[model samples]
Target: MAEAAELSDQPLFSCRNCQNPLALRSNLLSKNFWGKTGPAYLFSHAMNIIVGQKEDRQLITGLYTIADIYCCNCGEVLGWKYLRSYDVRHKNREGKFIIERAKISKEY
Candidate 1:
């Protein structure tokens, strides 16, 4: 259908500064997340991003080893990726990406 075709043509998220494609809407997992700037979204997969060094940090949920993610095109700090989680309850987030809502724009 027309809607399906349109959806396939556009990215779900993009770098606000450079408009580089970041993640597809299909990869979106959850919107109930927090980032350094403010609200964030969790994605099962992300593209056109650079994962920084892994560092352990104590977050509201628990201690997690995360890497700051940057937009490869513009080098903007978008959010962080969970490289490791100390708590079993948060293990599901180990490989997920948390993109800050303020750093990315919805393409649709």
Candidate 2:
């Protein structure tokens, strides 16, 4: 009963393609982010995601070693995870995730 209550209180973000739960609204850190397409969100945690190979990419912020994240259920390319950041200024985002706004839907 308590678990159900907790789940109900926490809104979820799911994949737009297959409705796979990706992250919780509580884990959302920032919405002022950019992805390959457009707006993205920074999340402190994410679930049901497959982290792809680590590679160095020069983003607008700086060079970062990131891995492409995919939906585990439908294998849709959702976003990427920051594996390593070359810049100290971006160190806080090292273990975080950037999920594209267009790829996910918010569930109440």
- Model 1 agreement with the true structure over 32-95: per-residue lDDT tens digits: 9999879999999999999999999999899999999999999999999999999999999989
lDDT of each: 0.91, 0.94
Q: How many residue pairs collide in each prediction?
A: 0, 0
Which segments of candidate 1 are over 4 A away from where they belong? 1-8
Which candidate has the top score in TM-score? 2
Candidate 1's C-alpha lDDT? 0.91
Residue lDDT tens for model 2, 1-108: 885577667899999999888999999999999999999999999999999999999999999999999999999998899999999989999999999999999999
Q: Pairing residues by index, what is the TM-score of model 1?
A: 0.90
